[model samples]
Target: MRWFWIDHFVEFETGRTAAAVKNVSLAEEHLHDHFLGFAVMPSSLVIEGLAQTGGLLVGEHYQFNERVVLAKVSRASFHFMARPGDSLTYQATMQDINENGAMVAGTSHMGDRLQAEIDLVFAHLPSRENDERELFDPADFLAMLRLLRLYDVGRQSDGSPLTIPAHLLQAEQAMEAATDLN
Candidate 1:
């Protein structure tokens, strides 16, 4: 999915915490169907935004080599409605990390109002012995990292432009083709 929340990292410290921001705009298409007059951002997408930010943090910490996905949400709560013209700040802190998985606690705030809180767990898939070089290029990883503004984590030693992997590029192309066909 295209990132619903195009977040930019404001603060990041590897193995510790990270903060990102997403500005809500009335021009966003989802707002049209969300509510008639009151275009409050959907809670599911808010959680997704937080998860994507948090997932990027964890993935970058591990050098984007492992196949990581959101395994579970331990706890999630929403307090206030996120409306258009609001800028949401999402902050996530690592609770624990291991070779197999990691946990993070995250909170989203709209100015002084708490919008949502979540505890997320992520699972890592190890590379197989003979899996076509694992299909993870450092350049592609770096590009995704940069796109997510996660390269500021002090872990990227080489500052190089990221390259998209051929496999992923092909998959995306196929998806586009299918959409066109449909």
Candidate 2:
């Protein structure tokens, strides 16, 4: 969670597919040190962007109740390096999801050109909290979703605005209260 590769989610469907975007810019520090005088978005960060898209798509099915983690990368291939000013769009489709884990196929594109394709595996871990808080605080997660404009524009398959679950809203309210006290 230290770095967010994706800038925002352009499309989100509960358990099916999601699309997100990331714009490579000259302002990013990592781009500078990656290679002296030659800046390109790192392949690893591109993979992470795809993983985030896939992981969120899979996790939404459980209502964010499970701790989802990237378990493995079955395959990842990039056709070309992305340079500054390039906008990358990532798409992930769910292959199959069950109680234990899920598999997803993701692809990235710069305009009409394919930049990368990835086959990923994700695992659901036993729930664990940090500092008496959930592994990922629902409030923080919701905030992230808001920042990504997911809730503002996300829609269900039937074309209804995606509503925030009651449990998550309650958790967010509690978090706000806790923060108020400190």
Best by TM-score: 2
Taking all chains together, each candidate's TM-score versus the true structure is 0.76, 0.91
> Model 2, 54-135: lDDT tens per residue?
9988888787777789999999999999999999999999999998989999999999999999999999886545633465
Candidate 2 regions with alpha-carbon error over 4 angstroms: 127-133, 179-182
Looking at model 2, which ten-residue stretch has the lowest summed lDDT? 126-135
Score candidate 1 by TM-score against the native: 0.76
To one decimal, what is the Cα RMSD in angstroms of model 1 from the true structure?
6.5
Compared with the true structure, what per-residue lDDT tens digits does model 1 show for residues 1-182?
Answer: 44547467877766667788888888888887888888988888787887877887687676565777889999889998888899999998888888998999999998888889999998887767776354345444445556766655333325342343355566556766878999
- Model 1: lDDT of residue 170: 60
lDDT (CA) per prediction: 0.75, 0.89
